[model samples]
Target: QMQGALEQHLARLNELLASRGDYVQTLKFTQQLAGSIVLQLQGLPAWRGVSADLTELSGQVAYVEYYRWLAYLLFFILVLTVCLLACLGLAKHSRCLLLLMLCCGLLMLVLSWASMAVDTAAAVGTSDFCVAPDKFIMNQTDDEISAEVVHYYLYCDQSLSSPFQQALTVFQRSLTTMQIQMQGLIQYALPLFPTAEKDLLGVQQLLNSSETGLHQLTALLDCRGLHKDYLDGLIGICYDGVEGLLYLGLFSLLAA
Candidate 1:
């Protein structure tokens, strides 16, 4: 009877342990389900929103960074070109050519200034450059029409801001002046030769004449005084051929 009671007690203990294990498993399952629900509810939307926000911000930064790189590349190219030109000028020992280049640069600067004054963002900055193969740089400003009476300065050159108006204007005045100067030059001076051909028998004679002309040209380029005289002579003589060049010179002087 004692042994049978001990066996019965042991069986009861085993049953209780099994019941506690079941209870603990059920509680763990509930806890796991609750944790899963809370995690999905909290993390899914939060992660999605965070991911989208990060992508949007990253795209903006990338776009701005691209523009900055493009701007830097363009700046480098411009500097490289200038350096090459300087090297070429120095190697050739052509001071007169250098002066002419300087004059042209000044003229360009003036035109750029005029455009900028009329519109704040005229020569698009390096950062603003685009990769379009064909570009149209048209003067399209709404205020340009109403800007008629404004007297603006293109560097040192004073000009009417508007391309219209019957009033005193710088560009129109330049045209009139150039025409007058041309009329005087064509009145005198040699008709320009068509070609510089040479005969086999008279090679030395041709060479001697060429050498003399080259020497005179070199002497004329020795100083600014002579250079200016040659340039003034050119204004009256090469009018039809180099009208653009003359205005460029005038613009340069005005700018300087």
Candidate 2:
């Protein structure tokens, strides 16, 4: 009977050791999975950073656009004032009005030449931008974004597929793969751990929001619309202003 009891005691001890081993392995697996999920979740912050940068750029461009429009408006008023003065000088046959008209005409002519000179210089500067806007923009950016990525969006051709699109595709694919892994870990690999499930669900939400932001960033980075606006500003301030002022000066001379 003592031998039978000793045999039972050994059996119980073996079972206990086996159970402990299984519990330790399970804990190790859980720790590893939790660490991986946390790492994957951290990637979402990059999306936030890109979004903020793009938005700030858009705002700055718009502010400059407002100033461009104001300059055009002031130029228009100046031209109108010169024309009205010339007309009054002719109608009233007044020497003072005529002198004023002559002075205004000279002023306009000088301004026209100055505008042309300034615009020419600006065009020379802008030519560099037209050639490689990405390089110009890179000078303004921080190290958070790589130069290669900026060039990918700026220099990419519309006739071909965009690198930004490819990046988004790959980004989404990676997120999907990681989410699948996390889901598997939570469901099959760690069902008994409700805390892991909560963490994984939070990660999934972050990834989902980041995916939405990525789509918006793709649209924002197109650069075509921004380029078009820049071209319009150049034409308005440089070409149109010069031509209008030249015509006004000629008309004033004819009146004299």
Candidate 3:
């Protein structure tokens, strides 16, 4: 749950930050509005640094996954070879093959113990995380996302209010106000300063786009989405990850 929630939040945060480009363009357009009415644009948080970090993390995950698959494949082959050698030795009554089979069986036994140890550690760690996933995620993402936002998603209870509601309200009001102002300017001011018509229309368009973005942002910030992701992640980790490890441990025991 913690891993899933963190990943979902990071992905949303990245998307929110990426929208800064449109905000920047809006700021530029707002500068032109300064001639008629003063409009102060709030600065967006820096996203490039966070984006770079996420990109690096993605690369590392891919690398790790590739190696994990390779390791599983190699282990499977090793077990199959051992089984084949045992069969060959028994059928042929060959001393050399039997000796080799003995050596492989000893190796398999050591490896099974090592694998069991690893599986135990992994299961323990996962159980620990499952106990207080929210706290773990909060600690991990303290530097990246706000505690209020994190809490809102971690415990998506009906009574809990959205952390972004106020911000979204303000954003909606601001967009409506801007759109009204732009419409008035286009209607009245265009007749007086015909040359400003192009800029006025552009600003109106930008305001519309911003309003759409605000709606999208509100949806993304909703707790249901992130909470669902968290639940799914928990299911995967608990049901699939741990179960698979147990199966592997069983196989190891059988091989030994």
Candidate 4:
């Protein structure tokens, strides 16, 4: 009876070992699928070129913006000083102060016109680019990215399905199936085959890591994250930067 029972346990272990080939095949496919999805994401313009450029551009813009504020403040103080000199000259009938005021007024006029001209030109150029930014971006990319991909990110319509949704779904299903198999072996076969405990726990740990990767991949594949970055760059350049220029232009006009 003991020999018969030993044979029965060996047969069950053999069946489980046979099924492992299928599990290994599924794991191999899942790894390939993950690699393909990552490559596809990296190939897109949003990830490859646009994101890097925007990050660098943001840093540059911040540096320039700091100096711009300083220049504006100095100009404002100069204008105020000239106005005070003019007031004192008129009250005291002082010829020397009046002469100084006249010279400073002429200099202010020239600077004001130059600043206004630059601001107008910049505002116009920015407006032109904003009018049909999609075309401009497409042209710049030189046909490297498809229009469909660009539109998907630019619009970010909820109705549109994610590009990697199918692959992610398959990955999730395969992973879950693998986990279930591993758990079954840990529960049922571990008592019969004590040596397999270490291998089973190791596979469970690997599957857990894969699950974490899947979550990260899903977040990266989502359009909203990239779209938010795009919008932020536009707001910084178009709205904030241009608005500051307009304020500077107004100050120039007042100073003039």
Model 4: per-residue Cα lDDT over 116-169, one tens digit each? 888888888887887787788877655456776777777788898866676677
Model 4 spans > 4 angstroms off:
1-49, 141-146, 228-244
lDDT to native, each model = 0.38, 0.57, 0.67, 0.72
Model 3 accuracy (lDDT, Cα): 0.67
Give candidate 2 regions above 4 Å deviation: 1-31, 41-60, 138-142, 151-256
Model 3's TM-score against the true structure: 0.75
Q: Per-residue lDDT for 57 in model 2? A: 83
**Could you tell me the TM-score of candidate 2?**
0.50
Model 2 lDDT, full chain set: 0.57
lDDT of 1 by residue, 1-256 (tens): 3223323433433343344454334324433433343343333112344346658977996897598458546534544554566677788988975776566565556654553342233223221322221121112221331222111111112232322222213223432443333233223211221121111112223224434643554343233453355346444334432444344334434443
Using Cα atoms with residue i matched to residue i, what is each candidate's TM-score against the true structure?
A: 0.25, 0.50, 0.75, 0.75
How many steric clashes between backbone atoms does each model show? 0, 0, 0, 0
Candidate 2 lDDT for residue 37: 41
Residue-level lDDT tens digits of model 3 in 131-200: 8877988897778777877787788987977766665665666667657656765665557556555555
TM-score (C-alpha, index-matched) for candidate 4: 0.75
Which one wins on lDDT?
Answer: 4
TM-score, candidate number 1: 0.25
